[model samples]
Target: MAVQQNKKSRSKRDMRRSHDALTGPTLSVDATSGEKHRRHHVTADGFYRGKKVIDTGSNE
Candidate 1:
């Protein structure tokens, strides 16, 4: 079994957890589709950075 050597102070504990806050995914707007998507990722219609990179074949 493991045990803490000393009681940690609230300030020290909170300082340790300062960077533990959750953050939402970073998003960028598509120049062509005018939609928001994750950075460096293709849009739903396969558009990336204003250019068609993949053929989603959703148009039927």
Candidate 2:
């Protein structure tokens, strides 16, 4: 018996890699043009990168 750890131990590592390749990078859209963009680090000023951050109340 043995225990596996992390991504290397997972047999689905290749699948994960493949998905990442297929999607390339995560980028938000303008909902108008199909152009791509990236998001910078989130700030505590209720803004993510440069866009306004919508705070959805907890559903708990």
Candidate 3:
């Protein structure tokens, strides 16, 4: 079996993992409801891209 000949340095290891940090979901405002929702996702009221895609059947 083969193994690493030298141990990786902390700075190099951290640099490689820089993009591994957790990031919050990107959100955008609904053009009509003015509500915040994740990009490419429907709002709580079932709105997508400023139009109704699903019928939540809510009185609001």
Candidate 4:
């Protein structure tokens, strides 16, 4: 079985894990809906950027 030869120091281990922290998804405000949504993604109402890209058919 493979095993670690030396004990990893806490500082070194923490430093290595510095980049492992989870980051929140990037969100952007929709110009048409004025709602926050993930970047490059359409809003719940099918609005992308300032234009309507999809017809959700919720009006009827």
TM-scores for the candidates:
0.86, 0.20, 0.76, 0.83
TM-score of 1: 0.86
Give the whole-model CA lDDT for all candidates, comma-separated: 0.92, 0.51, 0.92, 0.90
The local lDDT score (0 to 100) that residue 52 gets in candidate 1 is 92
| Residue range 1-60, candidate 1, lDDT tens digits | 999999999999999999999999999989887899999888998998789999998667
* Candidate topping lDDT: 3
> Positional deviation of 57 in candidate 3, in angstroms?
1.2
- lDDT (tens digit, per residue) of candidate 2 on 7-51: 374556776676665445566643333334554533333455455
> For each predicted model, how many residue pairs clash, with residues at least 3 apart or on different chains?
0, 0, 0, 0
Task: Report how far residue 13 has shifted in candidate 2, in Å.
Answer: 10
Expressed as tens digits, the lDDT of each residue in 1-60 for candidate 4 is: 999999999999999999999999998988887899999988999888788889998777
Q: Pick the candidate with the highest TM-score.
A: 1
- Candidate 1 residue pairs in clash (backbone atoms < 3 Å): none
lDDT tens string, model 3, 1-60? 989999999999999999999989998989999999999988999999888999999668
lDDT for model 1, please.
0.92
Clashes of 2: 0
The collision pairs in model 4 are: none
